[model samples]
Target: MTSERASPRRRDTWIVLAAALLARLAVVAWAASRFPPTADGTFYHRIAERVAAGLGYTWLWPDGVVTYAAHYPVGYPALLGGAYAIFGAHPGVAMTLNALLGALAAVAVHRLAARAAPPGAALAAGLLAALHPGLVAYTPALMSEGVTASLVACAAWAAAWVRDAVPLGARRTIAARTALLGVVVGLATLVRPQSLVFAPLFALLALAPLAGPRARRATLGFAALATACALAVCAPWTIRNCERMNRCALVSVNGGWNLLIGADPASTGAWSPIKVPDACREVWDEAGKDACFGRAATLYITEHPGAWLSLVPRKLAATFDYCGAAGWYLHESNGAACGDRCKLGLGVVETVYERGVLGLALLGLARASAESRARRIATRAVVGVGLVFLFLVHAWVAYAALVVAALFGGRTLLRGPVLPAAAVTVLGATLLTHAVFFGAGRYGLVTFPLLAGMAGLVLAGFRTRA
Candidate 1:
């Protein structure tokens, strides 16, 4: 009897997935050994412990009072809590989960890239995502980035599939896919409420007359059904917030805090401790303080429109500047254990990998923009030189590269093919969401998979053979 053999493309796909999983697991183990839970990790761990202990989602104060908290989104901690319940509350458990999620994220990126490119290109994209330093490094942290990244990529993929399925006239398939898209968006919003906007944003795109007047009504139906399903998924959480928090919070209560951090006169366009205004000094409750901060931030923004406007570039800078989330978080959590040299080395590795991929993505955008072969070559050469010069000029390369990529991605979303269009939509939403609140390297990790996919797509476009 002769055994059937797998095709080279199939083998390549498996290799990509295996490499992604192994890379993430190895990094998770290394990071687990080096860093202890700190900052947001501390909060997630403690909350998860409380959840595992059946204490609800309350934080035990220094005085031993148990007060329910919603300062952060409950999705990550609640998920962590479930894992702790099964495996015993441990940081390693969280890190392992993150590694698994990161692996799945790599798959999502590969699938997403495949929508617009060949199998070879898609596999390359998956490999890039699998080995991405930022994604792998962050696996050890008990943060929501892991969950958010995976969900965001899945959402983008699902949305793109829905877009693709529209022309097929498969009513049942469209409905099922639409519901799945809603579910993905709902889960994503639970982790990062800013993602709640995705449903409406995509729905608006669906509602557009681009498909002509005949398909317009069907697309409207799709949009409404998706919006309803998403709302249904999130309804329980919103109801819980209303009943328990005494305020109807859609997800978490940190929006005001984040907005205040980005809008205040003392704001540095990044994460910082929220300083209560005199008007909010008496507001001690989380919900109340959230409202107070919201009003205060609004006041500041209105009073100093120019100042608030100036912070936009700074916010983008903070969001995209040098990818070193893993190194920075580990260093901050336990620098004494890892030492400064190791931390710096990790930072250099992450930064170099980030810049390289980002530069290639920008070059891909440049190549795609030009019509003729000579023009494409000229554009690529010019962009290549400019990018290198920018890197040498200062750390501005990170900021510049990201900003340009985002702009080009936005343009692609408008006039490009469906697959790449969907990818850019996710990227645009992420950057725009953070632009309104604050920016941080960790927050941007949520989009690293998509970024890698974009770069992979570019590389594939240049490949002569599959």
Candidate 2:
């Protein structure tokens, strides 16, 4: 009976995966002609070309000065360089790679949802992920969000498997899953070092329970092992930074600069140019500049606590206000070539899709907490009203509701299923991380799959109960 139930769902999952790949490939095909790698994409492409040519990760100034650079995390460019080496530095190669990563993320979401929900819900989560507007739109941008987001989903799935393995008491299986979790997180950290924050959080939230001392011990052991493995994977990058950049940076050299950007009074809580403080003007080395910026930002925060705190809401707003990554990238890269109608249509689609998903996710979390039919119906009515208001009346009210809902849902899910709990924690962590540094619509793309999975789980629960 179990096999009978699983067979159809398995096949459907494959079909969903194929649809996701095809959809992304279609965008890639269009992007090949329309999107010509602009801004950050240009930076990644040039660096990748140099890397493919066997010139280490160095930046070439227009004046012809080549300097050793580590401003951005090396993982994405390095991955692109490896592909460029084999495929001759074509933009299509990067797009195709993103499609594959995006598809993997969908499957990872399926596995994650399956941990707590029925197989049908798991497939729904996978389907949602495969077709997520933001994920599909980001494929042509040559950005790290694709790789980082997919890695996040994969890491979450691996962590869920580790949680499942702990109850089985098979030491080898547990050890292997923990090791795999570490490796996935380690790679994720390479792409986006903030990923290190997720490793232990996922461990405690997913594995630790109020059950017994034995479970607590397993959680601690798992956290320690996964953290150690992730650090081990990053050891080489750290060593290279120490040797090449004269600084033992763990992952990247932009941390201090980013911090200062958010802390500066002139900041609008988004990406702004870093103004070198008086103390850091003389610093020439990347590591030294980063450290100097760090101190300056700390001083600013210490001196102006109120002002720095005020930026938190603004930062979050910048991160989640709207979603049009594909359109944004296309316009940035091709400008008028994207056409006004194309731009307007993409904007509307991105906004409606993002808002709908967010509303559904909020509803799912509410469903997870609803214990009685009365409460469930009330929750649904409130959510329905909120969505209607969000579309027709006011957005701020809806967004405020989402913030409150997330806080409440996160508290409730701490004792719920490991998969959903971990997913919520990731969402919380993303918000917190962006609040500290800076925020961008693209930065939150990493959470799309997790959000879809959570929504799928609750919707599935609703169906089962009905």
User: Per-candidate TM vs. native?
Assistant: 0.89, 0.91
Put down candidate 1 lDDT per residue, 1-466, tens digits, no spaces. Answer: 1223225556666777899889988877776767779988999999999999998789899998888789999889998999999998989899998888888878777766665666778888889988988788778888898789888777777776776666677878878888888888888888888877777556544334245676767777877787777778889988888888878898899888889899966677788888878999988888889999999999998999998888876776777766577877788888886678867888788878877776766666665653456555654555565477447623334434444444433433343444344455666676677678888877778767877887787777742111
**Model 2: per-residue Cα lDDT over 126-219, one tens digit each:** 7888888778878998988879989998898887787787667786787788888889999999899999977777766656543588767777
Give residue 460's error in model 2 in angstroms: 4.5
lDDT scores for all predictions? 0.74, 0.78
How many clashes show up per model? 0, 0
Give the distance in Å from residue 347's predicted Cα in candidate 2 to where it truly belongs.
2.0
* True lDDT of residue 366, candidate 1: 67
> Which ten contiguous residues of candidate 1 have the minimum total lDDT?
1-10
Tell me the lDDT of model 2 at 381.
62
Candidate maximizing TM-score: 2
